[model samples]
Target: MNLTQSEIDLDLGAVTMSCTTDEVATVFAGLLREMRSAAPFIRPDERDALRQIMSHESGALTAGEVFPDFARGSDAHTTLRKLRTAQFIRPAGRDCWDTGEHIEIRPFARIVWDRLGEAGVFGDPPELEEDDIDLALPGADEPVEVALPAPAKARGTRSGAKWDEGDVLDFLNDEDTQG
Candidate 1:
């Protein structure tokens, strides 16, 4: 039997699955839960630091690079160290580091996060049919017919202007025509 939502096709490396949009959102919710349980808690300051790194022009930078004003052993420095210990930031090179998988999953996580406050998995409920809608607005009297203005005529040309190759050649050969 048909359902409210159509089946969405999913392509895995070797296996494929078809599910509705609601099902996909539900799966993402499950993933979010598992990821949160496995990952360490990120404090507000640490989140700000991560935001700086993510918005960095180079896409990768050292903790010192991110918070240059914060000296070693300072609170901000300690925050960076905590992020490192949590593996939220991974070393990119000798000194440069970048966001880890947790940050990478943010795009998908955001969708789930938004849905947390919603009643459904995602998207608004299906719209009610006009016949099914019982409530009427204040202006729900006889339908008012509107008269739209006629389309404006094309500019820079006469209403019935038509030109051929001969007309073009004549125009080009006119004395007033510049080289």
Candidate 2:
């Protein structure tokens, strides 16, 4: 008889078992634990933005990295702040891997991807017997509705404690802003 995931009884009468993995998986598992606890509290777009970031090769990425020509302003600020507060993602330093030092990005994508997968959002994937069974928070069983907000029009960047888009010196090297 084929039993469904939720229906399977985990009684395991007299047998004992444990799950094991290397350092990376261990770290991932830790974050997954926190996320599972907080999943019920996570916002929709916040999850989407994080999931998009996680779907990338590197777990960390700026909102600009996720959305081209957008995500560099207030929306980015709000989304980043929300995820950070939820403890879903943490500062992984600047976007030094590619653009180098424009914005700070977070790393927690892979965990979120694995999270969405287990929700069956990706639909009926095969699972090995050794996988950890997650009794996720009830509301998490549904897919998060992602309503991506529009990017802010007036772009003003903050560097250090002060807000400055570009120095007059940096502008001198460019055309439109140049004399």
Candidate 3:
């Protein structure tokens, strides 16, 4: 198949949507306002514990291991219970817990980390140098000539040889064709 720059007709105008930063902020604010007022709140300590678990190579640890400050009886249980109720962490096996339902926390955290980078939380995103934007797109007026290989021939049962009625019977009787 051959195609040119001008031959490709796309309805990008209808498909594309754009908004100003202020408009995006306003919409996000409205969404936040619309959320339930009594949503569960995660404490800073719980966040720290989650980060600790995520930082661990296996993402599994005892509450005591995560929060050495607190004794492992009631206080640690309380914290783990709260996080479990919030569906953040759960029991891994005996004497240990992990992010609930064996969910991978690091990949999800990496996505958020990338979004934070894009939001300029770490620092201003690196400015694109001239070399980065030097590639030129072909204009619609310019001809884009493409040479495509001829369409492939229809294949047959024996490599490229088409089978007749006798050939089918011979193929079925041949021991080489048996499974």
RMSD of each: 22.1, 22.2, 24.4
TM-score of each: 0.32, 0.35, 0.30
| Residue 178 shift from truth in candidate 2, angstroms | 87
Tens-digit lDDT string for candidate 2 (21-59):
344456766766765665665567666776675565554
How does each model score on lDDT? 0.51, 0.49, 0.46
| TM-score leaderboard ranking | 2, 1, 3
Candidate 1 stretches with Cα past 4 Å from truth are 1-4, 10-17, 34-40, 54-64, 67-106, 109-179
lDDT of 3: 0.46
Q: How many backbone clashes can be found in candidate 2? A: 1
Error of 2 at 53 (Å): 0.9
Best of the two (1, 2) by lDDT = 1
Backbone clashes, each candidate: 0, 1, 0
lDDT of model 1 at residue 38?
32
How do the candidates rank by lDDT, highest first?
Answer: 1, 2, 3
Top lDDT model: 1
State in Å the error of residue 77, model 2.
1.6
